[model samples]
Target chain A: MVEPVLDVKGLEKSFGALKATNGASLDLRPGEIHALIGPNGAGKSTLINQISGALAPDAGSIRFLGTDITMLDTARRARMGLARTFQISSLAQEFSALRNVMLAVQARQGTSLRFFRPVASDVSLTEPAMRMLSRVGLADRANVPAAALSHGERRQLEIAVALAMEPKAFLLDEPMAGMGPEGSKALTGFLDGLRREAPILLVEHDMDAVFALADRVSVLVYGRIIATGSVSEIRNDPEVRRAYLGEPA
Target chain B: MGARETTVNVLLVLLLPAVALTALFIGEAFYITLATRIAILALAAVGLNIALGLGGLVSFGHAAFFGLGGYVAGVLATHAFNMEPVAFGLPGTTAMPAIWLVAILLCGLVALPIGLVSLRTSGVYFIMITLAFAQMIYYFAISWPAYGGEDGLSLSMRNGFPGLNTAKPFPYFVVVFVLLLAGLLLFHRLRASRFGAALEAARQNPARLAAIGISPFAIRLVAFVLSAMITGLAGALFADLNRFVSPSMLSWHMSGELIVLIILGGKNRLFGPLAGAALYVLFEYALGGLTERWQLFLGLVLLAVVFFARGGLIGLLAGRPRHG
Candidate 1:
């Protein structure tokens, strides 16, 4: 078997008296979309934060591409090809969508210290940013401010931004969280197409989409992974139903 | 279409000095002198704009860099005239380039420490910390007796500029006008660079910037230092133009005025600072001559603009901002 692209063992985090994550562990292999399903306060976002270097874990190790990345900062992790999408839509509201993506592309390309040259006029940045926007069906909205996009469109833009990084894996925090039925359907198709490109660690509450898209499903309750297996296996587990599924099989 | 835009942009830049010259030749008076002041002040405001407008760093202590730059020129010339060496046994030089270099270096050095400490917090804290640091410098300048303290130092003659006589009004105006143009051009170029985009991104969503392989704090610090350096250069020129340097240069009021210029013209626009400075000086000239309580009117106008006009003069004239 190929070595896991991401390996987390006994990762832990706490907020004073409240434990957010406790001995949480996950492993994602290359070209696999792993779904992390849990109730509110299940520590899914905290796990993603620790893994993405947004938050330092209290204990355990996080390894990416066979190197320990537990001590690295968020930017270092991103430079190492780890990318994340915020749970809330956080975008450069004033900038055009094209400019926003170009910013991400600019970071991966080279030093931004080249004074006396107009970066916006450069084909190198604009071309790829345009292509990324088109990929997410936002090509027409390229010139529009990011704040003007519809809720679903902004979510798609977030994905496009992550794609610009050419990340090894995407830690998406609820890409479908606030979407309507049509938006969810569109995003489901988008993710289905994206799965062929890279591994994704998806923290989502949409059960239907999780069952539909997840290559491997993990059930989390109170920050700990209670069950991890195929859909059928997870469905058949009695403890998972009472604790997470909230119903007997 | 893009080629057309690039050409228009270049042409627009070239047109400014031409317009400035016409203003100098046609409107000949102390008003021409007033115009010169506006031009130099605009240069200073433009420098501050890079940090405040583009980088989202509201530095209230920028006046400190401004004052330091002016002091560099004033002190150097004063010592050179007296044939005395400045501190550390360095002989004073009347050269403008050397003065500018020293000013840039000094401002950058001071900005580094200030940025390092201030960058630890952002938003209101950043504003207050920068303002506080500026006030500290202002107080220090007031207390320091070596440079005439609150009384300030005066330059009887203009410092040497190799090709031109620096004493003549029209020639001096030309020199300052050219420098102002250069500052404006440099600002435009800097705004369009990759570092600029990163700085803008840092302003928008720092967390997102961090997730894109850049430390927002580091980016902001670099921008802050560069911004201070540019503003310092303008300050040096400002001192040379007036042939005076004093604690007023370091005042918190000067810092507020710098911000006022940007906001009055338009924030983040290429010509915003220029337009703002022009209007401010004109208002002061016109209002000071007309009424004693002109500042009260100025205050009322400023409040109205802030409340009603989100974009300043440049925005009204140039239309909406093209960039984020």
Candidate 2:
């Protein structure tokens, strides 16, 4: 059997007395979008942070491509191909969209330490950065600053930056948040195509995108997985309907 | 670039050469010395600008590196004069290049620990930790008696520069000018390079930098060390300029002045330090000539810059920033 791209087993994290992520275990096989869904305060982000190595797990381990990465730092995890996007838009606001993506390209190329070459005119960095932007439908906005780009455009640019990394697996935190219907639909299409490049551990509040793209879905309630199965199973799960979907089973 | 930035860039390019020409044409040693002072101060501030302006580090311990550089020059020149070998049995030399090498290495060595510790904290904590480190070194210099202790040390004559009579103010000023331009070019090139991109990215959003697989701590530390090296070299020139080195070189006020020059010029603009240093030196010169209480006017001017001229002299003179 091929190893999962990302595997979390018995993960536990807390804030003082609050159990933020409790015994959460999941896996993402190659070419699959494993959607993690929960209501407010369900610790979805906390779980994602632990897997990305931003926050430490109180117990349990995260294995990426069969290597334990529970104690690794964020940069190390990213270099090991566990790429993530923040719930909030995290970008070098002062840098142009092209420059922002070029930063990721430079990281991928391992040339960020090179000080003499002008990054702007470097075709090696720019060409690939432009390609990432074009893939996200942001080729026209390449020269605009990240801060200057609109909300949807920034979202697209974020994916472009992540794509520039050529990630082995993706950890997306609410990638559909604040996105309009058209943006969400387009992103769903993009993400569907993205699963072929690398598996994704998706934590999103947008159920439509989740159901449309997720090959499997897991429901989280009060920091523990209540159910893990197909989209119809999660939709029919009685407790999930009461606690999350606000409906009678 | 905006029309204003282009104009500022043109003026920045012209100002130094114009100063050199006017001083030589007039044949005044005082003017030549003043120009040299500007170049050295600009060079030092350029170093501080890498951290404060570009990297957004706001380091207050840079004086430690600067003073260390000045002392390297003073101590080496003194040892060379006395025909005494330094503690390691290494013969001391008055060669400018050799002194610069030692100063840079010394600054790097010292800045490593300081950067390691200080980079752990950020914002006000980072500022205070750096300031505290500078004060520790400052107080140490005050009590070290081997180098004249509190009294300070002086070189018998200005240090030697290869093929140049450095004792002459014009020749020394030219050497300092060339170095100042080189420093500026370095700053210009670096801010547009990959390293600069990472440093700036670290400044803007460190988490984002990590997500892109670059460690912010490593980039900031490299920037801090490089900043120290630049300032250290400038400090060596400053010691030669005065034919003296003292604890005053390491004072907290010196650290404050370095930051002031960067802010007064404009943070993150290429030539902001040079423009800011020019304005500051001119203020000190003209204001001191007018009154002993020029500090009041200087304070008022700095206040105006802080309140209204957020971009400093460069920002006001230049148009809006194109990228950030």
Candidate 3:
């Protein structure tokens, strides 16, 4: 079998007395979308935060492309090609959408110490940024400030920013939250093709999109991965239905 | 900037030199000195604007840098006057270039540790820590007897420039005005650079900036150091302009005045400091002529700026800035 692009082993975290993630293990293979689905209060965001280096895990080893990244800071991880998007659409609100993507592109290009040239006229930064915006179907909204963009457009801008990182793996936390049906469908299609560029570890709630697009699925409940399998297998698992699918045992 | 702002900025830039040169043609040396004071103070506030305005790092300790620059000039001038080495047998010079260079370098060096400690906390904590650092420097200056202690240091003569007689008010004013233009130009260039993009991003959303792979702390520290260097240069000039250096340059009131200058003109506008300094000096002149309690009126004006003019003078004249 192919080596996993991202591997988490025996992850654990706790807040005071409550354990948010307990002995959870998962991996994302190259060219595949691994959907992590769970109910509310199931520690999904906590686990994602640990993986993204926003929170320190109590116990875990996360290996990205055969390198241990458990001790790295968020910015270092991002510079090393671990791109992520916030669950609640975090962006430079005062910046234009194109400028937002341009920042990511500039980060990917290396040090931001260049002090004389105007970023507005730098084609090297702008061309690639414009391309990423176009790829996310936000070309027309490039000049609009991130604060002025609609909810769905901001989400699209987030994805465009992540794309600018040229990341090896994407830790996307709830990319579908607050998106309307039409927007969700369009994004589901976009994400379908994005797996070829970099494998995505997707944390999401939209069941239809998850079922239609996920190559494999993992069911998490109460800080544990109770089941992991192909979509059809996960859908039919008796314990998964009882614990997360809300079906009576 | 829009065309309207650009035009306003041009006029603002021109107004200072116009008034100063008009004073010169009419043989009014007092107004030329007043214009020099406005330019030097504006240069100092321009430095603070980099940290406070663009980077949103409200530093209440910039007077430490301003005073450091002043002391550099005072000490060097004293050593040169007495024909003695400053330290480690290093001889001092009365050259303006050398004084400014030492002042800028010393301020940047001092700001590094201060920024490292202060940048760790933000909001009121950041403000308090920076203020505490400035106060420490102020007290140190007061207790250091070699520099005349609380009595302050005095220059027997104004420092020398390469091509011109700096003792004359108009020639000195020209040099200061040129330096002010340089400071404004640097601010403009930095605001348009990649580092500036990251700096503003750090100000607006540090987490978002970090997620994109830039450390906000690092950006802020750099801005802080740069701000100090510029402010320190102004301090050196200020010492030459007054031909004296005192602990009062490092006082908390000086820090507050720098902040007030930025707020009165506009927080982030290019000509904000210049406008604010001009307005402040004019108020001091016009109001002092009318009454001994000029500060009361200045306080009321500041209040109106804070409440009614949200972005300060430039904001009212130019409208809101188009981009962050």
Candidate 4:
């Protein structure tokens, strides 16, 4: 069996009386896209937050690259090559698109403490940043501020920033949330090939993208993984069809 | 920077020294003193801008550092004049360079703990905590009779600078002008550096910065300490200018004034503090000559700027910034 790139076991979270994540366990293997789909308020975001170290799980253990990262903070996890994108587009709005991506590149280089040289003139940061921007098809818009980018363009920029992290594993939460149909189709195609770079744990509402790109699918309902299997098995599973697909059993 | 801003910055850089030198040549010593005052205040505000403008950490107690710097100079100069050892049997020296070095190091030391506690909370809480820290220092300075307490300490003469005679208003103004230029240069370099990129990003979205593996707290703390050091240096110069150091230097009003200077010139803009200081001093001079209640008019102008000219003087002159 392939050693998983990321492993989460028995994750649990509670907000007051509501259980946000309840005994959830999942993992992502190398060179495969793992799509996690659930209805709204099924605690998908909470689970992602816990795995990414944004929120601490009440009870759980997460191992990434075979190291126990359950107690790490978000920045520490990121430095260890765990990169994630926000469901909401969060970026340095005033920074140029190239600069935004360069932030990730700079972080990856661990030279954020370098205080004297001009960042704009640093080819070590700019070259890789520009390459990521071109890959995301935002090369021409590199000089434009993130705030000025189109909605679809901003989503692409977010991915570009994440790509600049050189992540070992990607936890992309709702990457297609605000993208248009055409944008979604294009990004689905892009994400399909991105698995070659790093294994992805994708949380998406776009079922077509999920089904089209996922090597495996996990149906999460009310903070629990009801089923994990290949796309065909998840599509035909009676429990998944009834609870998530909203089909009569 | 755009051509327009470059031109404006050049003009600002030239205007102060030009006016002061002209005053020197023409024997208008009072104008030279006024120019010195503007330069010192602007330098202090420039220090505050690093934290408040770039890092978006609104520190309301920067006067703590400013006054700390002042007291360093005052205490050292007093001990030197009395020929007494200033603690640890270390002889006090009136050298400007040595005083500034001690002031900068002490302020950085003080800022570390203050920033460690204050950066934990942001927005109004951050402001209140910083203000509280400054007020604590202010009261301590008042109650501590060893350094004159509320009566304040005074230097018998302006502190010494190597080679140059700082006793003359013009030479002293020259020293201050050079330091102001250095401060602006530091601000420009820091604003363009990789650390600056992270600081600005931390300001815009700390979560995004953290997601990319940068700790916002670390960035903010560094910025805060650096800011305090710059402000502290300015305080040393300010005390030498007046030959006096008092708790009033650490007062909350002084803190508020530093922030006001930044806003009046233009927050975050290079030369914002200088422009604001020039305007503030001009108001003080022009208004003080006319009426005792001049602050009323200053208040109105500040209101107008806050209401109508959100960008302050530089924004009005150079136009809206190309990038935020």
Docking quality level of the chain pair in candidate 1: medium
Chain A of candidate 3 gets a TM-score of 0.99
Q: For residues B67-121, what per-residue lDDT tens digits would candidate 4 score against the true structure?
A: 9999999999999999999999998999999999999999999999999999999
Model 1 residue A64 CA deviation (Å) reads: 1.8
Q: What is the DockQ of candidate 1?
A: 0.67
Top model number, lDDT: 4
Top candidate on DockQ is 2
Residue range B1-324, candidate 1, lDDT tens digits: 134434444554454465556766786546546767888788888888888888888888889899999999998888998999998899888888888889999999999999999989888899899989988988888888988888998987878788987786667777788888888888888888888888888887889889978888888888899888888988898898889999899998999999998998888777778778877887898898899888787788788769877578766555566653
Model 1 regions lying over 4 Å from their true place: B1-29, B87-89
TM-score of each: 0.93, 0.98, 0.98, 0.99
Q: For the second chain of model 4, what is the TM-score against the true structure's chain B?
A: 0.99
lDDT by residue for model 1 (A59-78), tens: 99999999999999999899
Any runs in candidate 3 off by more than 4 Å, and if so which? none
Which residue pairs in model 3 clash with each other? none
Q: Is candidate 1 or candidate 2 better by lDDT?
A: 2
Candidate 2: tens digits of C-alpha lDDT, residues B106-202: 9999999999999999999999999999999989999999887788898899999889999998899889999998998899888889999999999
Instruction: State how far residue B172 of model 2 sits from its true place (Å).
Output: 0.6
RMSD of each: 2.9, 1.2, 1.2, 1.0
Worst 10 residues of 2 chain B by lDDT: B315-324
Model 1 share of native interface contacts: 0.74
C-alpha lDDT score of every prediction, in listed order: 0.85, 0.91, 0.94, 0.95
For each model, chain A TM-score? Answer: 0.97, 0.97, 0.99, 0.99
